[model samples]
Target: MIYWSANSTNSNQQSLSGSNPKKKVHSGNANNELEWRDLEDYPLNLSQQEVMIEEGKAGSSWGKSEINSGYNSLLSRTLQVKGSKVNCFFDTEAPKILVVDDHAASRMTAAALLAMEGYEVIEADSGAAAVVLVTQKHPDLILLDVMMPGMDGFEVCHLLKQDEHTRLIPVIFITALNDRRSRIRGIEVGADDFLTKPFDRVELAARVKSLVRQKRLNEDLDHAEQVLFSIARAIESRDPNTGDHCERLVTLGQNFGEYLNLSRSQLRDLMWGGYLHDIGKVGIPDAVLLKNEQLTLEDWEMMQQHVLIGEKICQPLRSMRGVIPIIRHHHERWNGSGYPDGLKSNEIPFLAQVFQLIDIYDALTSERPYKRAFSPAEALSVMWEETQAGWRNPELMQRFTDFIHTYNLK
Candidate 1:
């Protein structure tokens, strides 16, 4: 017979053995106190026989088949046995499901079903409660019910989707309303899927699994983007004169894209390009990159290779496909006098042209070691001269000029 102890402060330590099995032994902190509970009365049976002992914040699993088979599992996979005052070790891999329904019966039913599948389940009685739980717990998936008393599922989904942090967590509306209008509205509010009342166990499981998988993939992509941005920021840190250049470009490019009524995809590309456009400079030597004077012919050639290198570095990520053109062609001139490809007007990508305008404006306005910062009017005049000299797109230049003046972005 296996015996579990709680709040045992006896300083004696003993190993589990057949001959000298002690009634109680403390392995962790003496101050830790876990509530005494019988494991046999627990609901679910865990497949594994290991008992996890949590000491303070750290935890380790001990006792294989030696643990009593009659002991069932806690909500987590491992049977938690705290020594005086210890918490349980939470299962990080388990997918957390939030079930939102005003009706207690419906919410309990869904929560029970999910718990049976080994998923950690959270319950919310109303739409507002669901939102609060989402922020607090950040569940992997949400099973929502429609026709609630206060904020309905539609409103909840809408609010979640509008926030960038919560938007990606997949929401499945499980309501009695199977009308086409309801489904359309659900889709509009960014519901990943829908299930009519009395959702089939098999179907619900399949949908949840699929959406959760997709969410994981999106998380991986986001992680990759963050790494790339960190590298870009590090590269920028190499230049003392370019303070917050990437951030400035992102803000300006986003504003310009919005002013031009560009598509959302295009705006995203512009934002990414702002950080990644000069990322190729990572390949350039300090002599060329940090030079305060005009570049020598050899230095200029080496500097020009950065764009190509940046494009190559970013090409493997499928999400960067839209920004590749800006990375590669932002340096190209309208009159074909630029470096690398030297494509003339119309040959250059429009996004690249838009970004190039922003880049040039920022460079002119910001002080560099080689040149003093120009006033807004002076910068505009210089850009107009470049446009007149067939080195820039006149129409885009005109619109950008208007955008700057309208926004008073100095």
Candidate 2:
């Protein structure tokens, strides 16, 4: 939530009729004059009025989906603004909000207010309806009404919070319930905040704006933690034998990447990728991945599929786009004998190359099903031997060795 110090003046205009409507008329030359009119201002016949009455609520400003989207956007944007890093939640994108309410009048009112203050808004009508819409829409904030017939706001909030899939969403109760008891009830039921009926237009805008900033920051932090935990879990699940390996790997990889003069972005991705380098193993059968004996040709093929599987799993992270290539091709040898894609030398992704060297070192120094852990010196000797066979870049190997020497990576 990047805070823009813009004054958001909530407009009192009737709900906008539809998505920006435009009309065109022939520019009158010297003889004629150009004409223009708002499509909404046009009077309607009886049949047209009926159609308008039916569709007007949905088509007008602040439909159910639009309002819910506005609220959610506000929450996400606020969290982002308060988060540790700038542009943490959004990737050069505008904040969007979602509002959920049954009444079209309320929907339009909320949308008009939010729009006047510079928010992109979407709306949903009911709790049950919002569940499906929210999953697909993923608005930043949710403005939920407390009293709906089928599933009330509390039920909706509980459902959202309970779902591991959408639990991180921040919900603010927007209702006419101004009583202290009602507000407390709203809070008790999992609402982050409550906005009463007849909310001050200016105050409402300011509060929404402020909340959006805070929500964005929180979401940014949440997203970072989520990524870190995901990577850690992926590795732990893959190599259950190496307890705490992911932690050591992250610490060591961060230092090693820093030694290699990696950019901040590169360092971040390398740290994550390094910690979860063996995540692909999760896809391998337990027998193959945890084999106590040397792998046969078939077992080796199965073992190698982990890299591709890991790549697919990590593909959703647009931030780690660079990491995916490295993760996928890390096993390739310098001589092009690697499984999956047999790219050689400079063709291998650099992050994967770095992880390749560290990963091998870690594996050698850690206990496995088949053998006891090797001494640091023995691991170093093995790496040296592998280098001679053109399995790794000598310079990178040396750099890794220097890292071990400098940091005493144990």
C-alpha TM-score for every candidate: 0.76, 0.49
Candidate 2's displacement at residue 104, Å, is: 33
**Over the stretch 1-410, how does candidate 2's per-residue lDDT look in tens digits?**
00011111221122223334232212222211112223222322112112122343222222234434544422111111122121343455545567777765565456444543445566666787678767876876788888877888989998888887677667888776546766777777678778876546666665666677777776776686577568657658666787777777777788888889999998888887766566676678888867777899999878889888888766776665877876788888888988688899989888888888877888899997777999888999999999999999888998888888887745
Error (Å) of candidate 2 at residue 124 is 31
* Candidate 2 similarity to native, TM-score: 0.49
For candidate 1, the lDDT comes to: 0.75
Instruction: Provide the lowest-lDDT 10-residue window in model 2.
Output: 1-10
The TM-score leader among the candidates is 1
lDDT for position 171 in model 1: 96
Tell me how far candidate 1 lies from the true structure as C-alpha RMSD in angstroms. 10.7
